[model samples]
Target: DFFIEFSRQGPCILSRSILQLLYLPLFNKVFGTLNFADVLKDAAKNFIFPPVLMPKSTLLLNPQAKEYVDTFLTHCVRPFGNLVQLCGHNRARQRDKLAHLLEDFATLQDEGEWKTIEEKPPPSSPGRDSNLDLPVLSSLAQHDKRVSQLRHGGGGLDVDSYHRTGEAQCQRAERVDAYLHNLSLKSDSPRPHLACFGTWILYHTLRVMIMYLLSGFELELYSNHEYHYIFWYLYEFLYGWLVSALSRADSFLTEQEAMAEIHKGRGTKKNKSKKKKTRPYGREITIYQALQNICGGFYKVHIM
Candidate 1:
């Protein structure tokens, strides 16, 4: 609301206004990409005492001249900052508290601080009756591992232009593959390995997305111009997303490659005798096999 109000008054006015607003929040508070907190503080201040815009010459002559002017029509860009106000302050406050707790939890996990707790050692004496039921235990363990890593290895995008070169993308792909290798080992179920390479027709979608992000990253932007929204914010997001995806692909492919050798016949099923064919259908091949076939055929992109 605050930013949009500035927009209606034209470029020079909006730029000067925000530049001045940025100068006001001098280290007493931290600002974010959205700067929601600062914007809200500014709005409440304006509501109590609205802001007025003055011409450059007028401001030089009397800096306080606009302060005396009625602010009835000078509330430029005051409403856009209410982006998430539908949720009352009470709910927002609770969310903030919960967020802090989650941050602490994540920090602990990242640092493996939980391992610091001393656990009571198991008795060395053998039990009168001992049973080793491994199948069920192993299955459960696998399920828990997969569930935990469901959202793992993903991170915020790398927006540093220095990180966007072709060589960098390749390196990112390698790191992603390394992480995936670890994920696959935890599973080693033979299912994910197959699934990752087995799907067909995904490249059609992935190629388009990759190109869109690539183009957005290359687009030129003008300072204080209209391109900031598209170029800086959206493009940065897409680039990050692209980097994340490349890593995932690298991991999946790496696992698929290892599994390809293990399950020499990745996976396949024959059609009925009447419709029997020497070659396997797309669905019949393992995921890795499908990916290999598709990439080679469409883009001639080979996956090692």
Candidate 2:
């Protein structure tokens, strides 16, 4: 009851007709003699309190109701609805549970029941076609190449290729190093337009790195001599990456707003009166840039 009340009065919704079509029968069975839709309608009578008695913005438990509503609708509900309609009952979604489904496959050998008819290739020389040519992830060598590209301002990458011999010259870069490398490549592509998500992931990855490194200082984990290298790393990598990510996100938001304005100009004037709001990432870029400047100052002082 509390949950229903919360959701009804909270920051989100479903149309009554669709709701009736979907949930009314099940609810009627549970309600027995009672009228369910009438009960719901009655509960919603005070869903919006009169302006004289209470303002529409009066928050209950959540202070940031608008933000939460936007996130849930944009990030959760819309994606889920699109996915359900596009890929209904997809068997590929069950790939992660293969171990449990193995019993369903026809038995080929005493060791195991399998789906594929071809003989398994040798462990040392695994066939590329064995896995059905599903999307492969960027390799360490690819990561190195991407990081090199990002580092050198998107020019030709000069990094040595990773080979299976001789001291493994291609040292694995950090996870953020690997991820940020892909942003430049994806920015120009049309299909997977996930720059916003990419920026968010980069922020989180960089945050984790900064927090872990900061925690080491609090715990006295490093020797005095190691401080130089630690601070140097902070000045060079963590702060710079965070600022770059914020700038990318900020620019993307700007482009999106410009497109929205163009649409608005094309006759959609419903939201014309609403003033432009500052995006959170713009403030974040300013904050991180200031922090980077401070880090640079400290690094210079250490050199003196």
Candidate 3:
């Protein structure tokens, strides 16, 4: 809110406005795009503290400019730094917690593959009890545990945790979609532009996935044989999803632009020519595509 108020004061506060310049790069760093101008429009169009644009010449410099800068750093920059540290801690915690479930899941898959290839049932563990009934009872209890975990949204195997996380993610996305729809209907705001905020959320989710994958390399975590599936996970999951999200957002923005032109009565040949020159999110989408290609290439090389 302080930044919003400061931004409305004037573009020039002796020099370039500190908050405006900071917001551009900070938003870009967080969202992976510099197309946050649409969000700025929400303040104006929604009448939520609409910026009263003052001419630079008449603007009086704030006497507490130094204090504002220090406050901004304390409030904004410090929290961001804390967020980065929290992410790192979460990554380490996930690795520690999920490592065993991942190994167990992989072992189960390998056993299934062996059973198929050999045309026989899988062998029991080498250190198993001689009593067959104990094994069966143990398996049944384990199965019950897994079922209970699934029902209660508790952690079981790595795969079950993933499923629950995915479900929660979907639910959150649905809530956001509903919120944006309601917002547009109530306020008569541009929905697609506001929906860019949803895309920004997707971008942060994608970034977290990327960080999780990269941390594997930084810690020399995966083994030589595991590298194949690790790269496969990166290719199939993270980058591919990123490209899809970015493409969808870009299309939404383009449609929003087109509809806006139509509303403004700019459907002339000259306007069309100008529109042809503009490419919404062109650079960001291109970068995502390139990363997807690189991940695909790495995956192919690993598999081969």
CA RMSD of each candidate after superposition: 27.7, 20.7, 16.5
Question: What lDDT is reached at residue 48 by model 3?
Answer: 17
lDDT of 3: 0.39
TM-score of each model, in listed order: 0.20, 0.38, 0.47
lDDT of 1 by residue, 190-229 (tens): 1232112111111212222333322333432122222222
**What are the per-residue Cα lDDT tens digits for candidate 2 across 255-304?**
65565467567865566476767864677678877877777676667657
In model 2, which range of ten residues has the least summed lDDT?
106-115
Whole-structure CA lDDT of model 2: 0.36
Backbone clashes in model 3, listed as residue pairs: none
**Cα distance off (Å), candidate 2, residue 55:** 29
Across residues 9-40, which tens digit of lDDT does each residue of candidate 3 receive?
43454333343345444542424353333343
Top candidate on lDDT is 3
**Lowest summed lDDT over 10 consecutive residues: which window, candidate 3?**
110-119
The segments of candidate 2 whose C-alpha lies over 4 angstroms from its true place after superposition are: 1-194, 268-279
